[model samples]
Target chain A: MLNFDSQGLMPAVIVDDETGTVLLVAFMNQEAYQLTRESGQTHFFSRSRNRIWHKGEQSGNVQDVRDMFVNCEENSLLIRVKQHGDAACHEGYQSCYYRRLLPDESYEIVAERIFDPEDVYGTE
Target chain B: MLNFDSQGLMPAVIVDDETGTVLLVAFMNQEAYQLTRESGQTHFFSRSRNRIWHKGEQSGNVQDVRDMFVNCEENSLLIRVKQHGDAACHEGYQSCYYRRLLPDESYEIVAERIFDPEDVYGTE
Candidate 1:
């Protein structure tokens, strides 16, 4: 049996299926695991935010859980999610990861910007 | 001036610019902030993993950081990113934000599976 630290929460990597895009990653506690298993929708326990969040709660862009795999160590989870909507990012972008490391070990922005944050979050 | 607790780290949401996909979310310290600012690429501090992780370091799928926004509270950071390569999720899917909530408040898998994890991670 897998001994999970529900309070501690486990690490999970969320990935995109199409266009090979990675959407977002977060932690999953026992409650989240049970919820995810029961619901099949992506559920995460926000550490810094300290809350249980379901992707696309605020926005219509929801993450649909497809399959799950537990690491051999049984400490981490790799979740495959199918994204819906225009932009999963609250900032109005297609992905949260929009940076790349160049050959010189430096990074550069390669992808195009999609959404305006002011419209999404109602910036001040 | 914003009094940031570099040690404590700050919350960051990573999102895709295309198809409105959310890739991954992680924390960033002062150093990481500077690095990302200088590089224009996404960098994060893995809390549970306890290490500095550059997205797409292992896999070819790299997150290209596009723009950044600081929350009104001046605590959290919302980052815009562009994704390259296929299936950011280790399980090989279009997005990590898969699954959908039905009208019955139940969740269901909506997207099709694209890749096999064994091919990507190399099964044990």
Candidate 2:
């Protein structure tokens, strides 16, 4: 059995199938996990919203699963996928990990923003 | 500032600097984070052990940080490192993610075990 923690969630690391670049890290509840398996799309438990989130439901940046793996402890997952859109991050970057952390404890943008967030999500 | 969860922990994804292969996912509290920065080695907060764990302290498989990244939301981190020794998993695999999940929901070993856990950790 997959080991969900006390909060009934396990971390899922999403990776780019072709590039092997990690796209995002999200959490999955059992329901979200089953949904992802059944649908072959990414699903995550939204901690802030307290609901199941179908990734790319709003942005059309769906991730098509190529493969999934569980860690030795079975407490975490790694999913390699074909990202369907120009970007994965809500901030319009190809991956959420766009900033590099420097030794000085500061960060610098290391990736080119792929799209305009204002055009995709629109201003609220 | 990096966002730690309600429990004061943030997930850190470790990646192979040379291959971009994801090695492991672990949790880091602020102290562990600072220690990692200072020492250039991975440190994690062990949930079960209730303390900071210096990765490879006992096994001698320490991961030396090459670079680090932060996600857009600042809730997670990615660390690229030069992994010392042959393996990263306590289970004796190059990566903890050695099992690929099949469509039938069963998993298969996708990686070679580089060492024997019994030899490293001993029967405890």
How do the residues A1-124 of candidate 1 rate in per-residue lDDT, one tens digit apiece?
3345535676666666665555544668777777787887887787668888887787667888776644433455556678887466666666654545343534456556676777655766
Off by over 4 Å in 2: none
Q: What is the interface RMSD, in angstroms, for predicted model 1?
A: 8.9
TM-score of each: 0.50, 0.98
Over the full model, what C-alpha lDDT does candidate 1 score relative to the true structure? Answer: 0.62
The number of the candidate with the highest DockQ is 2
lDDT of 2 at A34: 96
Interface RMSD of 2: 0.5
Candidate 2 chain B least-lDDT 10 residues:
B85-94
The digit string of per-residue lDDT tens for model 2 on B1-124 reads 8999999999999998987889999999999999999999999999989999999999999999999999998999999999998689999998999999999989999998889988988999
**CA error at residue A1 for candidate 1, angstroms:** 4.4
Candidate 2 structure quality by residue, lDDT tens digits, A1-124: 7999999999999999988889999999999999999999999999989999999999999998899999998999999999988688999998999999987879999999888989988998
